[model samples]
Target: MAIWVCRAGKKAVYVEEFLKQEKIFCTWDGFDYDLNLYDDKEKLKEKIRKEKKDAEPTAINTWAAQLMCLKEKMQNGDIVLTPNENSKSYNIGIIIGVYEYKSEVPEHFRHGRQVRWLPDIIFRDKMPQYMIYSLGAYRTIFNLKYENEFVELLAKLGIPI
Candidate 1:
């Protein structure tokens, strides 16, 4: 399974909410429609530019790519790693459901996927330097570059990989 790093929110603002709800979400306010409806990232980008006229070209591109990754690239059974700044720990889980538009939730959190979290929490202090570096990515969502090493580390920790 592919592994991904998905942040709850800047500074882990939505960490507790995500853990409580058993889901992972990304915020792109006003674009609440199902991402599956879009034929490709370019279409989504066009829509974003149309709706958010003030957004910069770079921001628009980033949002479109990230949203597409969340909706299309990610799949059921993929491993998800979410960092919790409050606890200085990383929460691991498996994506158990497909992309969904949860209009019932707050506007920023409308896009999400259900997750089944593992009971264990890996503290930052205990992680390797490479892992720390990789997880320090600026984007909201990204695939792990060192997937095999990460899986090996998890196996060593007695976590089911």
Candidate 2:
């Protein structure tokens, strides 16, 4: 299963709230369009480029790539790690459904994917240094592909692999 690191909010203002609610995760609020509407990531990127003309190429790419992840790459069994800013812990969850566009949510968080937040929380200090580095990436969404490292993490949390 793939692992994804998602921040609850840019400033982490909604980490606890999100964990409490156990809803979906959203990113790139500026796009404003429902990412679920597009099937092709390239097409989405093109649209982003046209709409956000002044945005840097890197910014546009990051947004499109992450939107694509939410739309397609993340599967039902995939894990998600959303760091808890109030503590040195992560709010872990498993994706349970496909992409969803909730217009009722605040404008910044319209594109989402349902997640079943795991009951246990993992503290950063308990994880290995290498895994910690991977989790420290600045990107909003990424593939955490270190198999052994993840195994270690799950084991530490008493979660069966």
Candidate 3:
């Protein structure tokens, strides 16, 4: 299964509440419509660019692609790492459902992907240097492909690799 890192918010502001409430992982692009209208990734990106008139090309591409992946590529059983602000640690989760739009939630978190968050925590200070570097990326969402790193994390959490 593919592994992914999902940020809680720009500065991890929602980490504690979301985790405590068992809320799903989500993002804000101010997109309130269906994302599946355009089958082509590029076309969808162009649409997003128009919707976000002031966004730079790089931001548009990154946000649109990752948002699209939340609906299209990310699947059930895929791993998710979400940082917790309160503990300064990462919470592991498994995607458990497809994309959803919840109007009841806050505007920035309406688009969501269900996740079965694990109870185990991986503290930031305890992570390996390379894994720390990988998590240091500024992107909102990204693949975490270093098997050895996950192995180490799982080991520390007492979950067999």
Cα-based lDDT for every prediction: 0.86, 0.78, 0.75
Tell me the deviation in Å of residue 161 in model 1. 3.4
- Decide which is better by TM-score, 2 or 3: 2
Report how far off residue 139 is in candidate 1 (Å). 0.8
Identify the leading candidate in terms of lDDT: 1
Every model: Cα RMSD to truth: 1.5, 1.9, 2.3
Could you tell which candidate, 1 or 3, scores higher by TM-score?
1
lDDT of 3: 0.75
Give me candidate 1's TM-score against the actual structure: 0.92
Query: Which 10-residue window of candidate 2 scores lowest in summed lDDT?
Result: 20-29
* Clash count list over all predictions: 0, 0, 0
Question: What is candidate 1's local distance difference test score?
Answer: 0.86
Minimum summed lDDT over a 10-residue window in model 1 is located at 27-36
Instruction: Decide which is better by lDDT, 1 or 2.
Output: 1
lDDT of 3 at 9: 81
What is candidate 3's lDDT per residue for 67-94, written digit by digit as tens? 7777788889888888766436888888
Ranking by TM-score: 1, 2, 3
Model 1 clash pairs are none
Query: Residue 37 CA error for candidate 3 (Å)?
Result: 2.9
